[model samples]
Target chain A: NAGVTQTPKFQVLKTGQSMTLQCAQDMNHNSMYWYRQDPGMGLRLIYYSASEGTTDKGEVPNGYNVSRSTTEDFPLRLLSAAPSQTSVYFCASSERLTVYGYTFGSGTRLTVV
Target chain B: DQQVKQNSPSLSVQEGRISILNCDYTNSMFDYFLWYKKYPAEGPTFLISISSIKDKNEDGRFTVFLNKSAKHLSLHIVPSQPGDSAVYFCAASDTMNYGGSQGNLIFGKGTKLSVKP
Candidate 1:
């Protein structure tokens, strides 16, 4: 079973370009999160949704936005990609609010030139 | 500022030896701490965790120790094997707020561990 799937595993975009990072999970989890991993910076939250139709900005949400229309799909959009946005993006989900931990996707490696 | 810090950027341990990775946090409200392991090109996976109420928690060969007063935590892997080589990340959350939901984990930069055979 595919726990979580992210599309465009690798991508290189010119500065000022726009792109969407797709995340889907088969676990039917209630919560979904978007995070970007940079050098010397762990996974910093970009955006998150506790449930469908409810999204919240995270620590670093300036250049990104997220929409969770369905429980299984949560997509992240970069309106104007910049070189500073180059980083590996990860998508994660948890079954509940417990400490069981989150199931993560393989991740999308994005590079803004 | 980094709320959670993994001071060691990397560590090397001989096979069959103990691998101890350390983490420190500045947030006093953080009560739940966890360790995650990640291989190249993959996402981090949960390894072990300890709550503020518990000083230590063990699962098989992996153990997590929490020192609340010191705001420190460590993950110990006994009899380290070659397969244990990877980047380890420390994450903590304040469960009191929103019941630990809303994606409240604050993570450290991570420490890459190498188990040499």
Candidate 2:
């Protein structure tokens, strides 16, 4: 099973452009999260979905939005790209909040120029 | 403010020696702690974890020790191997303030561990 897979492994975007980073997990986990890792910084949560049809803002949700229409997919959209958003984005899923650990996807490296 | 911190940006250790990575947290509400290992161009993977109820947890050559009083934790890798080279992140989870929201994890700046052979 592809534990977690992210589309568009790498991308380069001009400022003001928009894009969506696709994330999917086959583990049927109830929790899904979007996080961005900047150089010298820890991974910060951008958004997360507790379950299908439910989404919530995280520590760094500004300039980004997310949707969880189905249990297997949780996608993150950048409305208007900015250079500050250029970072490695990682998608993760977990069975539960407290007991299980997250299974993260190979990150998407986005460069907003 | 950064609630979780990994002061050391990097560490190098000889093969067959112990590699100790440290993490400290300022939040007392954190009840769970975890360590993740990440390779280049890849996402972080869970390594080991310890609950607040326990002071120490061990798995194979990796052990996690928590000091509740000091709000500090450490991950120890014994007889380190070259393959153990990677960045290590320390994370903690605390309950959401209101609305029954699931707890969120706060991570520390990772420490790059290089195990020389």
Candidate 3:
């Protein structure tokens, strides 16, 4: 089974452009998260969903929006891309906080110019 | 301000030797700590973790030690191999009151480990 998968492994967008990054997990985990990795910065949480139909803002949620329609899918949308938005995005899923570790997707590298 | 910190930006060790990575956190409420390893173009993988109640936890060649009083934790790898070369991140989690949710993790800048053969 594919544990976690992200679509559009690589993308380039001009300033003011818009796009969506898709995340899907076959693990049926209750928790899903989106994080962005920048140079010299570890990983910052962009958004998260505790379960289907629930979403919450994270540390760096300024320019991103997320929706969790199903237990398996949580997508992140970029309404207006900027050069500062260029970074690698990762999706992760976990069964629970204390019992299981997160399973992360390969990651999507986005470049905004 | 970064609640978690990894002072060492990088570390190098010879193969078959022991490798130790250090981490510290400023938040006293953090109860759970974890370590993750990442390779180029790949996502980070969980390596080990420890609860505040415990001082040490071990899995195979990897061991995690937590010192609550000092607000410091460390990951130790014995007989390190070249394959162990990767970036290591330290993360912390605490409990939150909102809906009784477990707090989101706060991560530190990672330390890149290089195991020479």
**Interface RMSD for candidates 1 onward, in order:** 2.2, 2.9, 3.0
TM-score of each: 0.97, 0.96, 0.95
- List model 3 lDDT by residue over A24-81, tens digit each: 9998799899999998888988988888898888889998999988999999999999
In model 2, what lDDT does residue B7 have?
A: 98
lDDT of 2 by residue, B3-116 (tens): 999999999999999999999999998888999999998889999999899999999999999999999999999989999999999998875431134358889999999999
lDDT string, candidate 2, A1-113, tens digits:
66999999999999999999999999889989999999888999888888899998888989999999999999999999999999999999998654357999999999999
Model 2 regions lying over 4 Å from their true place: B95-102
- In model 3, state the lDDT of residue B37: 94
**Candidate 1 per-residue lDDT over residues A20-54, each given as its tens digit:** 99999999899889999999999898888888898
**Residue A79 lDDT, candidate 3, scale 0-100:** 91
Better of 1 and 3 by lDDT: 1
User: Interface RMSD of candidate 2?
Assistant: 2.9
Candidate 1 on B1-117: residue-level lDDT in tens?
889999999999999999999999998988889999999999899988888999999999999999999999999999899999999999988887743334388899999999999
Query: What TM-score does structure 3 among the candidates reach?
Result: 0.95
lDDT of 2 at B16: 99
As a TM-score, model 1 comes out at: 0.97
